[model samples]
Target: MSLELESASVEQTQEIAQQIARLVEPGDVILLNGDLGAGKTHFTQGLAAGLETPTVPTSPTFNIMFVYEGGRLPLYHFDLYRLEDADELEDIDYYGTIEGDGVSVVEWADKFEDAQPDECLAITIRILPDQTRVLSLEPYGGHFEDIVAAIA
Candidate 1:
């Protein structure tokens, strides 16, 4: 399933994220695709809010990943933007992370498509000339089809 949503402001973008977060389950993988300054981190912050995480969310660009607890489920946030290849994924135990008892959101996931699970939710954010954002959600398998349908 596929969906297209428009967010005219940062708050709207985050609100949309929260709506999706409400439906997340453990072991779910969310792939975020967009260029720099596309509000990926902001969306993540919204997810954290919906998950009831106490810690504030931040971009994992330099650290590669960050773990947030104190929520309904833990959040394993990953930023693969700086990685050279999927080989680096092993260093971070990428597969293991996503398989854990929490939800995983990967930024710059387009870089390592092969490493992504077949049943993940992929969100692509496009910036328009008016500074609005167009978020396109694509579900790779039946697991995410319901989510896309509900959020759409």
Candidate 2:
């Protein structure tokens, strides 16, 4: 199953993010694919809220990943936009971190399309004219599919 939401404002987009965030649990991977200023981080803010604690920081464009603890689950936020080599993932313990602690949310995760992920939820945000936006989601694997079905 899938969901397409028309967001009228940035807050609505964050609300959408929060809704999905609430459904997330540990051992989950979320790939947020979209262009810059496309509300990916805005949605992530909502996820932070769902984590039951919130955070504000610049994008991890150079830092790679930032781990926020003290939520219902640990939230690992990764922005892979600056990565030049795929092997660098090993240095960061990429896939290994997905199931070990809290949920892993990767912005610009399309780089890992070949390596996809187990139980990964892919969210694609598209911008339109008139300040409107489209949010598309595909939840893969058993647990993530259950997340989709539950939302449906």
Residue 120, candidate 2: Cα error in Å is: 1.1
TM-score of every prediction relative to native: 0.98, 0.92
lDDT of 1 by residue, 41-98 (tens): 9999999999999998999999999999999999999999999988899999999999
Number of the top-ranking candidate, with TM-score as the measure: 1
Residue-level lDDT tens digits of model 2 in 118-146: 56899999998776888888878877778
* CA displacement after TM-score superposition, residue 68 of candidate 2 (Å): 0.7
lDDT of each: 0.94, 0.81
Going through the candidates in the order shown, the clash numbers are 0, 0
Residue pairs in steric clash, candidate 1? Answer: none
